[model samples]
Target chain A: MWETVLSALMDPVNALFLVGGVAGGIVVGALPGLTATMALALMLPFTFSMSPEPALIMLGGIYIGAIYGGSISAILINTPGTPSSIATTFDGYPMTRQGKPEQALVTAAFSSGIGGVLGGLTLLFLSPALADLALQFGPPEFFWVAIFGLTIIATLSAGSLLKGMIGGCLGLMLSTVGIAPIGGESRFTFGFSPLQGGLDLVVMLIGLFCIPEVLAMVDRKRVAKQGLALKREKGVAGGVIKKLVRQPLLLLRSSIVGIITGIIPGAGGNIASLLSYDLAVRFDKKHKDYGKGRMEGVVASEASNNAEVGGSLVPLLSLGIPGAAPAAVLMGALLIQGITPGPDLYTRYPDLVYTFIIAFIIANFVMFVMAFYGARYVARMIDLPADVLLPMIVMLTVIGSFAIRNSYLDVCMMLGFGIAGYFLKKVGFEPGPIVLGIILGPIAETGLAQSMLLGQAEGGVWQIFFTRPITLVLIVLSLISLLSAVYIQTSRAGWKAGRRDAETCDAD
Target chain B: MRRRLNREIGVSLFFLGIAVIAFIQVEGLNRMSAVFPRTLAVILLVLSGILLVQSLVRPPEKKKGETPLASSRILPFLLILVLYAVLIAGLGFLIATILFAGVGTWYLCDRNKIRAIIGSILLGILFYALFRFVFLVPFPGI
Candidate 1:
């Protein structure tokens, strides 16, 4: 491991490309309406020319940089450049409003650096052990793991659990639009050649997330606000470092939340950041200051979101199941490099794995150095005029969308989704749930169907799933998640009623 | 605004109608095809039912006074898109993109003629050059 790390550090070309990739990713991510997925997709073609190690190193750099870069826009514009930065905006923008934009930038940078390093360390130590454990999992266990991922729908449901389930079912139904899995029978082609190929995940991702954002931005031409002249505090880095040291537990806990959520397939940085923010609020004694420009909120969110980069790789590297959307794209990169993910990855390519781990550690440190010096300049970007910024974003979104596969179909799909997403937002149905459902739907359906088939093949429908302890545990956990959601809704309703009665009594 | 909501309802119903048609189309297939689409159609039917019920239960709320785009604006945008789609394959990416960007910028930029012209030209040239020279992404030469 030490040798591999040293070798990776010594390679000048690898280091240069890594820095370049991080720079590119930061630019892509700092722009509103341009997501990390789009950045990865756009950069994929460039990777075709490079060797595998440098290519993977660059992609890893981009991944980490993009996740951290989103916080810049979130802090300044109140528009999260990526979904993962949504939690950061809760406190980050308020800090900007309070004329502490510099502090927010520094805090975010510091937390992101710490979180990224912690996540990388976790990946380094935990992955080999997890990979060893993954060897014990059979087809049934894999099916259960997929089912566990799908159960996230229950937690993510917005208005009604039923609607969320219907959305998930719709996604699953769409997944079956092309050829059948087991049998070679055509299902729903209806004579269209394109439909036979089914909807591309990248196209769907761009449409469902990016297009809607672009259309919304166009409709509401948000004028970028000029930066407030902050009173230059003594030692900005010292201040940020002092705060982090004061709240060591908060940083540690948020990073853990990020890593755990990231390791779970289907739940990515967005969910991880939100969950961590909630946990921070719960634990914070002075929670009243949370949304009112509290530095802790920004710290918790930035830390967790960046940490998810390393956490997300766990499942992707170990079980061949991508923990997040970007990881899914990275999985494609790995396959393109002729490296298959599974048990054999660690055994055969230990050097590559170790190199990636070391690159992550180095990338975090590089990110820290860049963000530390560059925060003020990056913050100044918030002042760019709306006319210039809007046009630039629109142009980038168009180019980024088109650059993926060089297909016009993708562009059209993006426009369609943008219009649809705008309406979905107006109606109070969040797009995150739908996007997550679409991603996890296929895995869930195939797993459930295969598990059932295996059961039937074994003479009884319930024997295989019920007899296995792990399968039984996962099924029970899924049931508990559903019941808990229902219970929470009911309790909230009851509490509202009690509060209403008390108010009436006081009025009387 | 009422007309817009009514139009949305009509569109959604049309999609629901397609779902039904698809369900019927797959009725004759073996057990595999029959199961998935039928399930999808049922789900779509239920969603449409919920949408219909929600529409009735709570009338579509309107913002204070912003007028829904007259069918005139809607028709033109749709026409522009459809025409671009038709022209893109035959006319090639460069010309089609230039025309599309020029027209789109002209329409979207609040009728600023100079900005529209310059923005469109710059976008077309910059994107074309970036893709063609820097990235070497092949665009069908027209």
Candidate 2:
């Protein structure tokens, strides 16, 4: 492990990939409406020729850098660059209005850096044990795990559960487009010859995530003429380090919250930051300062969101399950590299795993250095016209989709999915669950088929799910996940109704 | 302003059609090939039906005043994308990319013609160099 770490550090090529990924990620995250998932999707084809270690190292840099980069626009323009930075805008924008924008920026950067480092440490420590436990899982357990992932889509669609489930079903249906996994028979090719190989995951990813952003940009071009102006100040970062040191507990607690949330499949950085901010507000003596230029609020939000980077990777590395949308893209990257991430990942490629983990830690530090010194210049990226940016992204998306298999069918399929994604988003359905469903669909299907084959030999199909202890645990987790999503939504509605009733009584 | 319930009903109906088509297609397949797709199709069908019913029964939520980004508005851009995909096959990678970028930049930003053309050409060259030289991805010439 030490040798691999040293090799990664000494190698110029590894450093290059890390630097490039971090720079690109920061730009993507700083751009409004661009996401880490889209960036990964656009770049996925580029990693096709790369060795697994370098490919993952580059992705890790992008993941960590993008999470931190979101706070830049959140502080300066009151627009969260990524969904995760939504909480950052609460206090971050207020500080900008107070003429202390630089301070808020520094606070967010430093907090994110600390949080990222802590999350990386948790991943390094916890993943091995998790992988050990996952080794005990059979086909039935795997099926249950996939079901648990599908259930989390309910949580993804908090506002519209029915729509979200439909999106999941859409994804599952699409996943069945090419050929049956077990039977080696075409199911839904519609007589199209090119589709026998299946809808390329990279094509769907770019189409669904990137193309919609471009279309949205064209639509909003008429409204986004005015740009945010940023003024840079020196010496603001020095004080933030001192403040971060003073509030070690807040940083630790927020990091813990982020990691835990990230470990749960489908709960991305946005949820982590929101939960962390709530906890911070509850414990803060300066509660009134929240949503009003409070440094702690900025710290709490940034820390947790960045921390989610490490936490999300834990599941991807251990259980072959994606912890978030970006992680799902990473899992695809791994599959393309012919490296299945599970218990064998630790045994077969320990050195490579160590190298990737070490690179992630190094990337966080690199992000810290770049964000601290180059934020003023980086903030200018926000000013680029949507017209120019959209066209450029379109060209990349077109090229990226075509490059997957050098097929026009893939490109056309991407456009079709892109159009579909745009309509889906218009009606309040998120693209995340759809993407999640596509990624997990095959895993669930294959697991179920394989489990069935094994169960027939063991007397009965029902016995497989009931007899296995691991399967039982997974089933319970799945139920808990699904029930809690519905429970939370109903209770929130009831609470709002009660509040409205009390207000009416008070008025009377 | 469009009502949320109306939009929901429309979406649900669209998905319902998709589900019914999927279900019909999988009907003659072997059990092994049909089980997964058929199960998902049924789930989608049931869910969309529930969504349609709920949308019909619920009171319409207050409509927001902002002009939502409609897919209809972006239909022209989608056509442009289709044209680019077809053209890329005829013109090859670099030439098609340059043409698309230059023309697309001009189309997207109508006022700054010269800047758009030059900047887009540079962008095209940059992408070509990055993909061909750095990543070594294959792109056929015309």
Candidate 3:
């Protein structure tokens, strides 16, 4: 593969796509209201002229670059450029307000690069093994997987587990509005034909994530504002670089989370980032500082999301199942080229596949080099006035949502979701669980219904779902997650009470 | 009852209402299609019940907190956004965007009328160029 690949790699057009794809991806990703999915969709037309290898490589580059690019807006403006970057805004925006935007961006770049490389390496070396692992998953297993993801709500909501659960239920219910995965029946349409397609994830994402923040910014008073000026530090973000380099465990842990999440079809970086962020909070002594300008928060999210880029490819290459939204677009690109991707693809086009994988790894390097230096200039978005930034963001979001399916209904849905999300956030509901629930609802429902049918043939539903080896393991993991969340919440309450008693004793 | 009310109780009741609505909607669907949504609706009811019980047993102690955003200032802007979305259907993308951007900026921009005017017009053109020419997004009136 490498022998024939050297000449293909040397091709000028491939080189341009590799570099330009990443750069263009980053720019699109950095803008508010834009996402990597939109970037890839727009780039689809350009791929018709190119050969299969270059087309796949260009889409791969864009996929990598755009996912990473989302962090820039997430950090500086409190808007995630993509759904995966939702966790990035948790700490990234706070760091920006605290005058450490430069450090946050640098941390994101390094962690994302490491995660991307690790994911790429996994694709290069472990795809065959991982793809085979993916085959073990059926509807029942996927149901457990979605349930396992939902358990993250326990730890995901540091405020109130009850509210998180309720929010998750709301998202799950929203997901059921469209056609049933197996029954071929529509439940919630109430005679409206447009809704038979259900709610678009991108529409909900824009509404629930971006809309609330813009409204809050409009309502917020200047007295509540922190350090408004962007900080310019010395070389390589000065001390922040050393601090990040020291936390190799955090990088590796977060990347592994991304990689694993990516391997599972339907589970994307959005879940990975949230899961790793939960893990970081669960393990750290200063877990309380997580949503409040923690560098570890940005690193955890960016690393995991980027690593997921690599992880998402595993399923696509192996089974033809797309692991994430962008990966779904890449699958379309492959099909358009008349190249069907699956197990047969490995034996059929070894050189083309191998070269593209190698090129994907190199694209991550280019992303780091470009994003690291380019971040400072990008961070200058802070210098733009709220008046200018505010309306512009809304405009971009309108265009972004509209571009998805060229429909006004999506734009309306976005506004509706944003308004609902704003009120929901005020009442202790975090978007992570709700979004997770939405993402998992389809998978969970499809799995449950299909497994029930399988169970009828195999003897019983319990035997089909609970008796399987993989199903049993997932059940245990879900139980552990639930128990851990309860323990953490109780312990935190006790700690606060104990400190209050100590203070009272001191006063006496 | 009003005095005992809190965000927890409010949210709980709201979700409980949703669950009830879901139960009503599941009537026409068959066993398979009804099962999942029905299950989710039950879960929502159970969680909301727990929350309601928890709040009733012991309401949270009120603490001084940061000022919440005033809806008076926020609602108008939110309405404007809805208006923007509505106008896109009638007036098309170009006209709707320019009006929304200019008016939204003017409303938020510390009263810099000239800047708002310039920014909105330029933004409209910029968005038009990017989406229409470069991306080839075929939104009506683009």
Q: Which candidate number maximizes TM-score?
A: 2
Cα lDDT tens digits for candidate 1, A86-105: 88997898898897887898
lDDT of 1: 0.69
The global C-alpha lDDT for each of the candidates, from Candidate 1 onward, is: 0.69, 0.82, 0.78
Candidate 3 docks at the CAPRI level of: medium
lDDT tens per residue, model 2, A252-358:
99999999888888878888888798789889988867777899999999999999999999988998888988998888788778888877788788888888888
- Model 1, span B35-68: residue lDDT tens: 5456667877777677666666665666444434
In model 3, which residue pairs have backbone atoms overlapping below 3 Å?
A: none
Residue A256's lDDT in candidate 1:
93
Worst 10 residues of 1 chain A by lDDT: A223-232
Q: Model 1: residues >4 Å from true position, as ranges? A: A1-10, A32-56, A77-81, A89-99, A154-162, A226-234, A266-270, A320-322, A325-354, A383-453, A480-508, B1-22, B30-85, B140-142
Q: Rank the candidates by DockQ, best first.
A: 2, 3, 1
Clashing pairs in 1: A211-A418, A212-A418
Regions more than 4 Å wrong, model 3: A1-112, A123-128, A154-158, A221-360, A484-508, B1-4, B60-70, B140-142
Choose 1 or 2, whichever is better by TM-score: 2
Model 2 TM-score relative to the real fold = 0.94
